[model samples]
Target: MPDIISIGEILIDFVSMESGVTLAQSPGFLKAAGGAPANVAVAVSKLGVKSGFIGTAGNDPFGRFLKDTLNSYGVDTCHMDLTDEARTTLAFVSLTADGDRDFVFYRHPGADMMLRKEKISEDYIKSAHIFHFGSISLIDEPARTATLYAIDIAKKHGLIISYDPNLRLNLWPDEETARKTILSTLNLPDILKVSEVELEFLTGIRDIDSGLKALKDKTSASLILVTRGIEGVDYVYRGERGHVETFKDVKAIDATGAGDAFVAGVLYGIHERINEFKDGHMTSKALQDILRIANACGTITVTKKGAIPALPTIDEVKRFLSERLER
Candidate 1:
């Protein structure tokens, strides 16, 4: 049985080959399996945890590609659903000169959004130590019902719930809808991870301390991780606050799945100490260790290209950290 089960979209990202070009103006593109929850599943698997992905993908080449890619990374896709009603979602990513990205999606009710509540497996949900998800699945029907239903099952089984509201405004009807939907689920996850931009958007606070406080006010999460890109991560656990500085030597070639990689690191850290969780003794020190590795994971990811391909294995992360510390 897998230790972590991630439920959400699993799609392919077509990255523009040229830098500083719009999707329409790009000469060529590269394909990679992406989606925040799926990325985290692979990252956790690579770090030596048994991980599974639960979602729907189109019964097409792109969908097959995603399933194969997840398997290659040691992620179990046994609980996944393949549908012919909709094509697999595709996002065209345009890379900016500063390594940021813009996305143009081609998902007119993509297969991922078609996941029904009936398709989610109760046995599979009960088997995992943690249930991880993102807000993308909550934007539409059927999938939204499925997501909430899974969370309920996970809660019933006492699995640690993890959530990352990897917000993409283009997928929602409006900012208000996005805000309302995402904010409503704040207190649902035992572990919550959000980027700096998401924090400001959700809480209307740009300052780091204020933003964290705002989120804490909204959720009773055991851990709230705030990713700060190059500056590193800010975390709050059991009323203790800490920050971890990111690796400075790594140059970001692309910023696609960096946050997802960080999420994996955090989950892996927690998985390593599942016994502590069972005992209800998740200390601040344990959380800081998790964030430190998570920062390293994000640092390694952006230094490469693509999302899934950019993710580092456990040995790679350890070696990178060792080399950086000795420098």
Candidate 2:
């Protein structure tokens, strides 16, 4: 049985090396395997966990490349669906002077968004300890309903549900629809991971405290992880007070996939029974250990490039932690 099952989009990212350039305008572009759920699967696999990914991709070369990449990373691709009707989703990412990213999507209801309810295997959902999903699958048709259906089955089977609203604005037709739909699914998740900007945009609350409260009140999720780039992470449980921890500084080459790497670390810690978050209480020591490991994973990912390719192994993470401790 797989330790974790991630269900969502699987696609290719065409990233520009230069600023103010689109895929067409850039002098050079790099093709990399991407998509949030795929990244999470790679992250989990890199940490020595049995992880599986379930999503649809075209029968095209890009889709084949993605599947091959996932298998090479040790992620089980048995559940991946391939169809010839639609092409693979493509993301064109442009970097700013300060390393911030802007995305342009080339999607006309791609294969990932065409996932059908019949394609979701019962054995796949029941065989996993955790079921993770993202917002992209909620943007479109049969896939929207299919994703929710899978979540319901996973919850009924007593699997822990994890959500990451890795929001992409360009994909959604309107902000209100995206906001409403993504907010509605919050209650179904046991753990929700959101970036600072995502929290603000989701709740319309500028203050972190207020935003956190608003999300908790709305979703009733006992565990909430809020990631702040460079400043590390802050987490909140039912009775425990939230706290922020800073991480050691490193020369970050690319910020892609850092959050997914952190999520994988937390999941690995939970799976190994290292630091489990209780129903109503979480100890500070436990939280600190979780953050430390997560920070190490995130830091290691930034030192590399790409999303799935950047995920660090368990030994790499330990080595990073050891070096940082010595410093």
Candidate 3:
């Protein structure tokens, strides 16, 4: 049994080797295991915490590789399914001059869509203290229903729910539908991580404070984090708010999965102080420390290429913080 369980998409990422190019301009790519929730799973596991992944991967070469990759990171995949219903999903990523990412997905009917509600085990979900997910799987069927059902189970079992909309506008049929669909379920998670832009899109407010206030009114989330890339994270926890700055001056080559790495850091921090979070007594100072590590995770990730491979281990994160302290 794992302390954390993350459920959703598991796929391959084809990252363009060259920076400062669009997908059409990039000449080549590097195949790597990715998918937001899966990245969180591996990132937490790398921190030496027990985490499990539950989702569907195709019974193909890419899918098999993803399964092996999760295992290599010591992530539990007991409830993971390998299905023949659809081929694995693939996303081609190209980078801008500033290491920002642009994505083009190749999933007519991705194997991740094969995530079956009936196959999800209630006991497995209950075994964990936290359940993490993203909205990508919410874009379609089977997975949508399955995600809802799992959320229901996690809530019933009193697991701390975590959501990072991980919104990819291109994946949706239209912006309005994406907004409406995601908005309808805001009241679900205990923890919510959204980028500053995501909060703006969801709340229709450019002002970060007003947007966070709007989101807080809608959800039961005790903690809401707004990531601003290298600018760092702005957060509100149970009515107390603050900002945490990221590591300064680190060269970035690829920004893929940095958000996921940050998500894992936050979750692992809560996982460490499960009782305090569950009891609604987690202080802003404690959370500040947590976000600092999360920011470190994000910074360390951008300095490398690919998603999973870039995620730092707990020791790696500790070393990073130690070095920063010694500076």
Candidate closest to the true structure, highest lDDT: 3
Candidate 1 on 104-167: residue-level lDDT in tens?
9888889999999999888989999999999999999889999999999999999999999999
lDDT of each residue in 1-327, candidate 3, tens digit only: 999999999999999999987888889999999999999999999988999999999999999999999999999998889999999999999988778999999987999988989988999999899999999889898999999999999999999999999999999999998999888888899999999889999999999889989989978898989999978999889998899999977898889999999999999999889999989888888899999999999999999999999999999999999998998
By lDDT, the candidates rank as 3, 1, 2
Error of 2 at 39 (Å): 0.4
Candidate 2 TM-score to native: 0.95
lDDT of 2: 0.84
Candidate 2's residue-wise lDDT over 1-327, tens digit each? 688999999989877777655556778767899999999999999999999998998999999999999999989999898888799999877765444567888888798998889988888899888889999999998889889999999998978788998998889989998899888898998888999999998999978788888878878577788888887777777646566565657766667788889888877776665235534345677766877898889888877657777889999999988887898
Between the candidate structures 1 and 2, which one is better when assessed by TM-score? Answer: 1
- Which ten contiguous residues of candidate 2 have the minimum total lDDT? 273-282
lDDT, model 1, position 255? 94
Between 2 and 3, whose lDDT is larger?
Answer: 3
For candidate 1, list the clashing residue pairs, or say none: none
* Residue ranges of candidate 2 with Cα displaced over 4 Å: 19-25, 278-282
Best-to-worst ranking by TM-score: 3, 1, 2
168: Cα error in model 1, Å = 0.4
Which residue ranges in model 1 land beyond 4 Å of their true spot? 278-280
